[model samples]
Target: MRSCIWKSLTLTIGFSQNLWAQSIHLNEVSSLASGAGIASKPLLLMMGLVALSLLPFVGMMVTSFVKMAVVLSITRQAIGMQQAPPNTVITGLSILLTVYVMHPVGLDVYRKSERYMNYRSSEFFDKANVDMLLKAVQVSEEPIKHFLKTQASEKNLQMFYRIAQKIRKAEDRPSLSMNDYIILVPAFVITELTKAFQIGFMIFLPFMVIDMAVSNILMALGMQMLAPTMISLPFKLLLFVMVDGWHLISKGLVLGYPL
Candidate 1:
């Protein structure tokens, strides 16, 4: 009788487990059937959030953000600040300036998008988008062309014009297209980089003089062990402040670009 009771108890536990497993399987099957017919709202929302997260990065790459940020960052570094003004501050300033520079182009894009969404007008959307982008490219192109004319040789111009001509021929157009805009972006970027370096060299000269003078004075005064950087930093800051260096730099940068 004892053995039979133990056997019955074991059988009961096993049966319960099997029933539970079957119920779980049924639940999974039901879920699959329901999921097959419709997308979950949560999933759509998650995807939208992911796309939104990437929007800033896309804007940085495709707009004036990259050039502005790079130039400002380089200028900060050249000043020998070594994160003195802070990366966040530099980036924030760059963003504000980029917004100012790109405002008109952005307005054009926004107007076009609004018209398309409100009127279901594909033609207007296409026309507006293309025209806005072209205008932006044209604006950006002027600065780049100016830089190239000053820095690059005639041979470089020939090569660039050849590429532009090829692009025009491929599109069977006498004017630039969106694809041409792609080529112009990198060309413009290179031009900006070159100009930034040139400007950085000029900016570094005064600081370098201060550094050398401080180092020589420290050594001559039998204080060779003193760090020149610590001694020179204050003077550099004072000079920068007195001369309104920030204003001069910002004005030069803003004016350097062709309208």
Candidate 2:
């Protein structure tokens, strides 16, 4: 009886010791995981902050802001009102117009990046969510790519393709596709610039005629000392107001993009 009791006690003690060892190991793992998680959070936050800072510039490249701003600036120049609306006003107006035009694209991106949209900004300190954030970014970029591709001219795209081919190794050069932003972005920008200039030229024509007509009248009036621009400015403003120039320009710009 005594020997049996001794063996049973020994077995119980051995089992308890094994359980204690396992508990200690689990605690160590938990502490290490928490430590690593804590350490990584600040790094993620810094990267996020950097990305936020760069987002506006990225926005300018990918959105209608480039074309809108250029056209608006040229319009202001055409009106001979260099600073009448002010630079801040022009930039703000351009941004508002860009947002208006790009709202559908934004919605599409948000829908496609549902994971990102669902991500709680309140969880800013969470390190594990970084991978999800990156995945969201990748998915979100697709819609912007679509927008750029739709607006980008094929000839301009080919031009950038040739340039990119020259820039990279023969083996590294990828085929020109909307999927590649490196080739697509410059092409989209140049295309926007070309279209903006074309619009600007049309805007200039009416104003140019006004200036010339005013110049001839002044010359016949023996008023060479007075600038034609000064005399024509009031008449130009009157003509623009009569035809609702702002409304027409805004309508044309909004309508220019394929629905």
Candidate 3:
């Protein structure tokens, strides 16, 4: 998970390189031949720090984290569990499952950018070379981009692409291509959310039936004063345990992502 998060940060840096370029003065580099050595390094470090600050948001959106987290939360609710697993446990399990699924993509990013990552301090930092950083980020981002493209639904992609075109001015519309990360990320998120809800609906069925049965039994017994939830909770828990729900849920969520 850490690896994937860091790799995603590199992609964020790549996306913001133009902004970084704008912040630096080109005349300073022209005036002082060693300006890159003195000035560029600190600016790059600051930008990297900013990228780190956005890590959590980027990490959650691009990975299987959202789908896993949402599905787990839905599972807890369906089981009539208000707090037994706790929010923390659900979040931790989702993150771990995301890590398991994304580990390969992280490794791919590392392998692709290994040469830039392992540069001698003198080569990478001693000189002011923003191109090297840009190239590294670009190389690192491809695997993640491919992952998003694969998981994102074509219907959502087309929807977002059309929306992006509609929002942009005619000339700018041509610049906003279908493959852009700006378009892909939102589409990917919507796709994941749609899948999570579909899975949640399936999970809710049996438990819903249990609740209905308990409620009807109470009605037949003329026990309207008693809460049906109190009666149904144990049966829901029993059914969950009997089917080994946790194992099945974990397996399905982990396998849902393309590793």
Best by lDDT: 3
> Estimated TM-score per prediction?
0.58, 0.80, 0.85
Q: What are the lDDT scores of the predictions, listed in order? A: 0.53, 0.68, 0.77
lDDT per residue for candidate 2 within 45-100, as digits (tens), equals 45335545555666687678889889989988998998977989889988988878
Candidate 2, residue 220: the lDDT equals 99
lDDT of 3 by residue, 94-127 (tens): 9999989999998888888766654444533334
Residue 13 CA displacement from its true place in model 2, Å: 57
Mark the regions of model 1 whose C-alpha exceeds 4 Å error after superposition.
Answer: 1-54, 111-114, 120-179
- Backbone Cα, N, C clashes tallied per candidate: 0, 0, 0
Top TM-score hit:
3
Report residue 70 deviation for candidate 1 (angstroms).
Answer: 2.7
